[model samples]
Target: MSDSVPMTPECYARLQEELKNRIKVDRPKVVQDIAEARSHGDLSENAEYDAAKDRQAHIEGRIAELNDKLARAEVIDPKSINTDKIVFGATVTLFDTDSDNEVVYQIVGEDEADIKQGKISVTSPVGKALIGHTLDDEVRINVPSGTRIYEVTEIEYK
Candidate 1:
């Protein structure tokens, strides 16, 4: 067993879909490629065979990793969350006092975090600072560049 992975139901479903595709589609294609490459000529000089073998290894490794993550998944539904304070699956709007700009970020699991998409991992510095804070709370976070100050303006579960 491994440490439990906290993720939204959507993220869990996406992982399951990826696992299914790898096992049912990618695995067979790679196997066929390997067989075709083997029929070409000498193993030592066959670049296609080596490439196919490498692809097969990568696919297998990903399959195992996805299986482990799915097995240890702890799915959290955003719609069911009810809290005044910030927590997992919370879409938070922060007002940056220094830049005088507002930014929205959704606190999500590591696998689902995408800064460009306004999703931040719960373990991130900003996310850690925002946790347990209610609306209008001032949060100061330290990043790689420097320190930043933000005021919580809005909090939404969905």
Candidate 2:
């Protein structure tokens, strides 16, 4: 069976854009570099040629990876989700009982996870605990710091 990775529509679009750039712009640039290095003479002592080849290999590997991910991507759109309980793509607001803090987080795909942007991966500890939870529900999570309790304050999809 083939493996499929879940991704938000925005993340899937970003991957497509990167793949297009790699094929259209970066690929040709690497080819031109290799050609230029080859014209510089003896291959036995051609450091430039060796470097170009290494770069070419790296670029090709990235292209292959991007293509594979795009081929197996499952795009989940936030706008189409309608659920009262927390699930993938749900933006949840929680009131931390520990430090008396309120924070917002959106459960997103692993590729789209960025703590600075308030997007957490579904497999993360906090995200996993929030799954299937509803507003006004209390959730307990164990972190490296310690165990803490949080009350689900809100849930929105956008």
Candidate 3:
């Protein structure tokens, strides 16, 4: 089963920008590098040619991956989301039960998850458990670190 990728407007824009950069700038550079490497005599002993070929393959793979993701992306504007409960693109503030400290996390797409930035993927254990939950609700998530619980103190769409 394929999962839908819910992306913020900014995330969608970033994906489009990445696709443009790969196709217009990086692809041409790789092709040129490969051509230059090809001019260096025997293909069997040419390290430059092999490296260039490898780089080309990597670039192609990334382009395809980005393209597929963009095609399947479902862009959602945070400002348009309802503010009653936690949802995609909602910024949630929670108090960790174990640590007794406040933590903020923005529920985002899987591709946009960055723990250091406090963006959690919607498919993540905590994010999944938090979805549709209202303020003051306790959420229990089973992570690799075992069971963890957090109290939702606030939910904001902006």
Candidate 4:
């Protein structure tokens, strides 16, 4: 019944830092801007006031969203887990059976997924295929190009 989602320690810290900035810096700046705009005059016709209000709304909405995610986050430390099998937060190295190339990818939460950084979402097809698999396990996944096979070469918690 919990809506908690898995998050890395780094990811949690990043979220906390962003929330702190929004609350401590961005929020107060917007308030000051609104105050300055209000002083300029008419409530309905003030474009600066309206713009400030909209910015405040966006900042507040983002703050709330970040707070909610932080509250529901289940921080999973990679170092805390000791397993040869691939799981969430595990860095996996695989050898492409078809391309004869090797690739490394870290299984991360959806929010931290960046393919260019070698981080893949747990919900992704490759992540799903790699999960629960161990070294030497042959994995076959169907891609748009066709079926591709990979041989798990390594799994690291760090």
Candidate 5:
């Protein structure tokens, strides 16, 4: 897809580092492994060679994916965003109306989203509903389970 991948500055740096490691460190190591496996015996019955080849393919695919993502990345710095409304990279606290519990989530890129860490992708249901909403705004999100209603309580950049 030609659509840009939106990410925080931190996420952009992390992806760049991973791409470098895959190219400079992992790529060479996989190549050497393949060479060693090929030297062992005939290719028809060499399990090591097959496995190494598979690993090499995986590495190459990942490298290509990383390159494409980096090329289309649109990095946004959370600290530099100045607005009261919810946006990408905003850490938001919401009061769940049904459960009467407060939940915190950080709006982040898809690559950086971790539910356990309270980070949600900007394209997610909750995140989509929270976008452009300000403190005290009531957001209704339609999730897989059912509909969820939440009140915006707090929003932080970092």
Candidate 6:
């Protein structure tokens, strides 16, 4: 199954930068580390060699994954979004119906989610429930813990 996730232009640019860094700086360094480790001793008992090989594999896999995501990315500028309704890339401020606490979240792409920064992935349960909703709408989201209700209070693009 394939679903396209919209990413901001800034997120896309960051992905490109990461891909370039991994391919140009990280890949060669790992390969060289593996080569040097191999020169130290036999592979049967070489921890450094094994670790380097594992790191190399992980780096290559991430590079390929990033490339795939970049190829499929639909870049949208967050600043261009102008809707009172919640949508991808919108910063939503909500009043928790259950707790009566205000919360703000930026709906972002999967790779950009950081709860500490108040950015939630568009695919998250709460984010999904909030999408297409406008101010004064009550949103009920089913989370792993339980159901939570939030009232939409504000939406911003930045």
lDDT of each: 0.96, 0.93, 0.91, 0.94, 0.94, 0.91
Model 4 lDDT tens row, 14-103: 999999999999999999999999999998999999999999999999999999899999999999999888999999899999889999
Clash pairs (backbone) in predicted model 4: none
**lDDT (10s digit) by residue, model 6, range 1-158:** 15565898888999999999999999999999999999998999999999999999999999989988998898877789887788899999999988889999999999898999999999988888999999999889999989998899988897
lDDT of 6: 0.91
Candidate 1 overall Cα lDDT vs. reference?
0.96
Better of 3 and 6 by lDDT: 3
Off by over 4 Å in 1: none
* Position 95, candidate 6: lDDT: 95
Q: Could you give candidate 2's per-residue lDDT for residues 65-155 as a string of tens digits? A: 9999988998988878999999999999999998899999999988899999999999999989999999899999998998989999999
lDDT of 6 at 37: 98
Which stretches in model 3 have alpha-carbon errors above 4 Å?
1-3
Q: Candidate 3 or 6, higher TM-score?
A: 3
Report clash pairs, candidate 1. Answer: none
Compared with the true structure, model 3 gives a TM-score of 0.94
Worst 10 residues of 3 by lDDT: 1-10
| TM-score, per-candidate, Cα-based | 0.96, 0.91, 0.94, 0.89, 0.96, 0.92
Clashing pairs in 2: none
- Model 5 ranges with Cα > 4 A deviation: none
Q: 2 or 3: which has the higher TM-score?
A: 3
Q: Count the backbone clashes (under 3 Å) in each candidate.
A: 0, 0, 0, 0, 0, 0
Candidate 1: tens digits of C-alpha lDDT, residues 11-123 = 99999999999999999999999999999989999999999999999999999999999999999998899999999999999999999999999999998999999999999
